[model samples]
Target: MTPTHETPTTPPPSGPVASAEDVELLAALGYEQRFDRKVSLWGNFALGFVYLSPLVGVLSLFAVGLSTAGGPSVFWIVLIGLGQLLVALVFGEIVSQFPLAGGLYQWARRLWNGRYAWFTAWTYICCITIGITSTALFSSDFVASLFGGTAQHPGVASTPLQRLLIAVAVTAVCLVCNSFGTRVLALISKIGLAAELIGIVLVGLYLLLFQRRNPVSIFFHGSSASHPGSYFAAFVAASLVGLFLYYGFEACGEIAEEVPNPARSIPKAMQLTVVVGGLAALLAFAGYALAAPDLEAVLTGSDTNPIPAILQSSVGTVGTKLILLVALTSFIAGVMSQQAAASRIVFSFARDEMFPGARIFSRVTSRYRVPRNALLAVNVAPLLIFVFVYFSPDSLVRIAAFQVLAGYAAFQMVVLAALRMRLKGWRPAGAWSLGRYGFAVNVAALVYGVLAMILLAAPTGDPNASFADRWIALIGFLVVSAVGLVYLLTAKPDRKSTAPEGDALEIAQRLRDRAASAASAERSEA
Candidate 1:
């Protein structure tokens, strides 16, 4: 078959897109700069915000939190924001040093070695692909509710077949948009950000002004559910609401090569994403909590979808549909942003010839300057994951959330490793280093990451909590990491023809020398 969107034969435009210093920095880091550097600072911020898509997360998981704890669980959003701020800061520092396509994967590769880097890429690639399925399912649910009557239960009128079809349709649209490259992707992101902001402000104002309950103090109350230990267990389970809200900001750094002055711009973009997304989530969640006409009944009711229930009560049918329409648009934008970022991860690995299908996946289309093959591959995995959505929506969302958090944990561990290397005198040369505050910030990030990972993997006290879903995330991450280890030991991609060139290889060689010298010095002391 003829190539879809014929591959560009000419080299990328070579005008003054990036300064000579930028090219030198990238070369030193072990990669050729190939993408158009047209994304402005605001565009970069939009990319991160669009990926995080707080509106989508809050709407989808608001019920999960309400049912998990109670009104007070909404407060967990603030705590998660503080913790994720640390992660974002560490990310900012690292991405500044190595502002490349792979983001965390590239950072890990430089911090340690190829084997460690490969696994980082592997885990994240799997997580986001599953995440696409999750996004699609949530989008479909909202779409179904928007079209179906107010009296219908969330899923009553929408059959499994209909849900899956909507999901596939949404995913397909995202894939086509992604194939058009960053210009089009950026346009979608900007529009989505505007719609999402409008939705949050409009919905929050409507709820607070017109529909809010009088007893605002109820926001602090815990859930009525009984935990075997303490109610704190319920609190921990409820915190997943906030935990889920804070990711996808790192997508800012994932396409560093495509942004102008990436070293400086990527860091600020990440920080803005955290701050803005956190605020939007607070507005959305608090609005939902304060607006609910009957909190106890909504939490304990047969229809556990707090968002729609609350919206229906607050704004009635017409207004609820309008807001859901905005949410639906934001959800589509989210899928597009996610696919775009995930494709970069694939393209980064393939460009280095480390992945299994490197030659095919690394191809960037000449016409659009996008990774067509990798985008296609990225889009296909979600359809496969849709199999789970088709058969087991509840179980799959829980499990997929688990898997995605595991991926987040893996990235945090890599960040900690980078800190260790920094402690060992591996200085960062990026424009946006943390300076005197590096050690403190890195420690905070690591601590927060470890705690969040454990809490996310812990069993919930919710009545719907399952034994299997509780353990699946941690156990699955271990299995995937082990498989990556086995692949490294047997296949040894590091020793093959695909070894990275430029600054990364040079740095790896120096690290080995430093290790050998340190060992010899210890022997002499003995």
Candidate 2:
């Protein structure tokens, strides 16, 4: 017979070589996956609302009260808002270009080296896991408040065991909701966000139009016991606290992989969320500043229940009830959003073989196409941490706060890495580029992020705090990271295969041929 086309009998490449090709194929497949762009956009925006609640803005006002206990000054609080805006812009720039599911971790990897990327992702996972726990604790506190019980009650707040039980219950409910699917989460978020906005608007309007208070002068100019030092220091401290209100825009970046046209959509969604959110926060702060009763009383009240005190003082029983109800909705929305983002982050890490039990964690459920295993991991890990809260209630709040702050710090560091890339002429093409202003915006964000971390770490005028209480948060973070470090060091890289590479090249060629053929057909018809 004429020379027959002999099929290659050689074996395919194995191990690392085979693995690399699989990864490339997976990436290409991801490019073909589609999501409803509008639903994705609104889902993201609603998620943003769930992320930033009017109640948190109210909490920021309490921070203002704490900072200015010696006097009244809204200037500093407003400046804090400005600082957050700058940071938001920097985040917008980076996430716009690289809207992947791994978020800051992926950004760190692409901008810096692979080794550092593992640590960044690890820190992010810990921060978010702890954050979910903290949100659950806060949700428990809010639920308990609805029943006229303070978080510090002997049965609830006084004993770590009691608090942990409450935390477990709340965590269970949130985990269930998250496991249901994104559509359910999105629906809950929309309802929760609407209730929160209405409550804030009603409360603010009542404060502004119905209640009569001291002239604006008191808010702009006054002094009290907590403000014994320089006004600047007080304002700076308050700004740090206020910045917490602007903390969750990065939630958008975490879900980027699920969004259609993510590179364009993520940046726009983020920018809109922050700008709109900042304005809303500003309005709420104005309402509080204008209607504040006794600044000292507001600051010194049980930190857990400051809003109740303010509402009771300003608008009587009815207003306080309304505020409580709205605050509950806000917390619920927050829990839902936290679970969604945290689960996605965990899933992304697992998909990359960065997490233990990756095969299970990375598997998407055939029923819902959701990462059920990852969701379970996200939910269970925190419940275990909540168990510790049962034994150490005093440390729970601080631990949660520290974990969230650490995550933010890690995110900021990655943004700084991207900024360095820009300096090195590694310009990425994208619809959401910062253009000429990227450098300045990133610098401001980095400075603000670093300063906030320092202030948060420093003692809050409290001495004699036990080591277990103060350092437990950092210890938890370090432990999680240590585990990730060991995994990254020992895990073998997956190999690539030439067959898959050849297959990809052939597929690409077929696509090009089809396009060319279509163009020729159209010309003939014309």
Candidate 3:
């Protein structure tokens, strides 16, 4: 007689809530399904766009860029846009292979080792958390301006305290939304993306067609600066405007686990996000620059926000406010996406037992299929830093931007590491890849990333600028990494514990056992 019974089956690891193909992919990577796979390709694309948030980055920083190097400085926007496309290509290859949550962190861990992954996650977490607070603060100022808050009317203008209150309020709403899980976040991001696209098209066309000041000259000329390298300095300073715009496209990669066929969708979504967002940003920035009635006057004037000033002149106050109201959704969407990506990263690190409270932060809620504790960790840490916004408000944006650039530089290093692995005969195992061209693309990404980092490191050419301001990126980089080192040395989490072996044969055995058990059950019932 054939065997009366078979060994107990593991039931195919239930609750994956994904197609068998997706489940197998995760299992091959040595992870069980922990998140609900609800986000679609467009949803992934939307999150990436929202993270870029052209309205927020372009509008808030346009005035600063103009002041730094006149109207022509918008050239940096286009240049950096091209450079970042190279970076995104390399990122696409990495995510295609890993397609894990914590995006950069997970990629580093898999590509190199646990130590590299720890520091990568640490830097990213710091950069994004600070970004959330600063972006919130930036949005609160715009919101305040919507209601007669201007330096022209000191008494009516929103005070620092009020701005802080609003910033905190915005952050709280983002936290609550994130707690609802990926489905809610995806819906909100899609709607926000629609609003952003509409605003970009309408506002850009209006400024370009009706309000062209000197469209042709705006691209070629660099205005007078006080120093010898002032033109170069101005260009460097303005590069931040574009640098800020290009990042956050990686946000899609951070939530890869929440998508089906992530290897295919995530990489495509990232590239498309960069391409679409880059065009939209270039148009928006160029439109504002071309539309400026008197670029020099606006740059030198006492108006704290020259973009709005230009907008007010071109379109009436009501029209400007209407545009701003739509832009506010971008800000809100940014916060939602930022929190989601950051929390996913935290969940990835914690699941690997890297942190002290690893087990806590790693726990996934069954209802939402989200990392509840990780969400709390990501938001609460940033709330503390938001308090600093009250005291040194001017430094917040600069510091946040610098931190992000530093993180990106380090992030590029991971791409270089992948290239090193490729040289050692590593082959692509993912659904998407650069084929034989991967090495060239990877090298280009490194070249672009290194040059961008050097440009970013250059000072603003202000002799009077504070030491902290001059080296803010380096300072932030050291502090974040130092803290990470301390924790890493002290805690010394076991690498093997968090580093799950990717044993395809082991997973296959489990599947076979489950299939055998199912067959035996049918025979008994028959």
lDDT ranking from best to worst?
Answer: 1, 3, 2
- Against the hidden reference, what TM-scores do the models get? 0.89, 0.79, 0.89
Off by over 4 Å in 3: 1-16, 149-158, 224-229, 494-496, 501-526
Cα lDDT tens digits, model 1, 271-368, are 99999998988888888788876677656544466677677767777877888889888999989888888899988888777877878988777667
**Native RMSD of candidate 3 (Å):** 6.0
Residue 114, model 2: lDDT of: 55
Residues forming the 10-long window of minimal summed lDDT in candidate 1: 1-10
Candidate 1 vs candidate 2: which has greater lDDT? 1
Residue 60, model 3: lDDT of 74
Residue runs of model 1 more than 4 Å from their true location after superposition: 1-21, 151-157, 226-229, 462-466, 497-526
lDDT on C-alpha atoms for all candidate structures: 0.77, 0.61, 0.76
Which pairs of residues have clashing backbones in candidate 3?
none
